[model samples]
Target: MATSFIVVLLFIALVGYTRLAEAVSENPTASQIRFLLDEDAALRQKLHTRIQGLRQSVSTLNASIVPCSCPLPTTPAPRTQVSYTGTLKSTMSSLNAASVFNFTGDLINVGAPYTPHDAHFVAPVSGIYGFSLAAYMSPRYYVYIDLLKENAPILHVKTGHYYSGSTNRQVNLGTNFVLTNMTKGDHVWAKYSGGSAYLFGEGVSTFSGFLLYEL
Candidate 1:
């Protein structure tokens, strides 16, 4: 801004000097020359005072500005991912009531929540979870399986038996899923509820669960 003001002042001074030179060349009068010089000096003094005022205004504006005092935006921490998958490796026949089916083969345990040693998935954090239980039975035999949470039944599934007089005794698969909320240290597992038959394993039965979201 100051540079532009100086350029405009120089242009005005040049025009005034050119007009004064033309007047002196035409009239050749000392009084007229002195009057033009005085007018030019007054105009220059007025412009210089205006420029000083503009500089003082710019300095005051710069001093009055304040930097932002508010805090910067923050990033949230990442969420914990919890999930597990296990399968029964051996078949169990003639199972007693409330028998817990241990899935010793652990395929995926992301947060180490599921313990295949005790067939229990202990929750590591409070959240909503989705559990799935699948069971396969031998031909001509069926069993009722229950998905339990801390020894209480939450979901039940049963395999179908082979029909009578059928040449082939076809095996049936039983599967069920339950969505439940669990707190930290809560237990979840599968149990054989009641049936004449038992659970068929050898990778045919599975138990899996995953945390949908945290509370």
Candidate 2:
């Protein structure tokens, strides 16, 4: 009860008219009362305007923000499933882009339609994604397998002899990304790190695989 009374008193003091009453003398002149009343009204207006402005600012801030309590998919996903595969007998030239059409690879083994480093795959599910890559480089060669969406590169790996004999390494695509961001018909593929290096799988090795997620 005491706390409630104190709160009510505080609220009363915040009002300009009540504050003026507190400042009034027991025997105040009429002119003094008028001037004090005007001042109180002015102060009240200022306080009211300030409160309104603060409310507007808060509303604007809330309007610009979006809350996400659930999972979000990665943007511009690779593909649902590769409808095509192109082999690379040679490295992809600077001007070459593999697939905008069938959404597949040039070939599982050869390097022609696109570059040799990457193989293409399509999305099979709609959810979050965790991608991993595994491949072996020949004793004297180097190879890199990178996942790509449309033309952008996603997950990638590098190994060769400079330090030859390295078989497989798995890399994270960062937890922030999800496979569901990829549309059902999006295109995804791997691009070669370099072309001239010796490759054991070349156009045929199935050392690499891609995975899609949902949830």
Task: Return the top candidate by lDDT.
Answer: 1
Model 1, TM vs. native: 0.73
- Cα distance off (Å), candidate 2, residue 59: 58
* Candidate 2 lDDT trough over 10 residues, lowest sum: 171-180
Q: Report every candidate's CA lDDT.
A: 0.84, 0.47
lDDT of candidate model 2 versus the reference: 0.47
Q: What is candidate 2's CA lDDT for residue 92?
A: 27
Encode model 1's per-residue lDDT on 167-193: one tens digit a residue. Answer: 544548988899999998999988777
Runs of candidate 1 with Cα error greater than 4 angstroms are 1-47, 63-67, 97-100, 104-106, 162-171
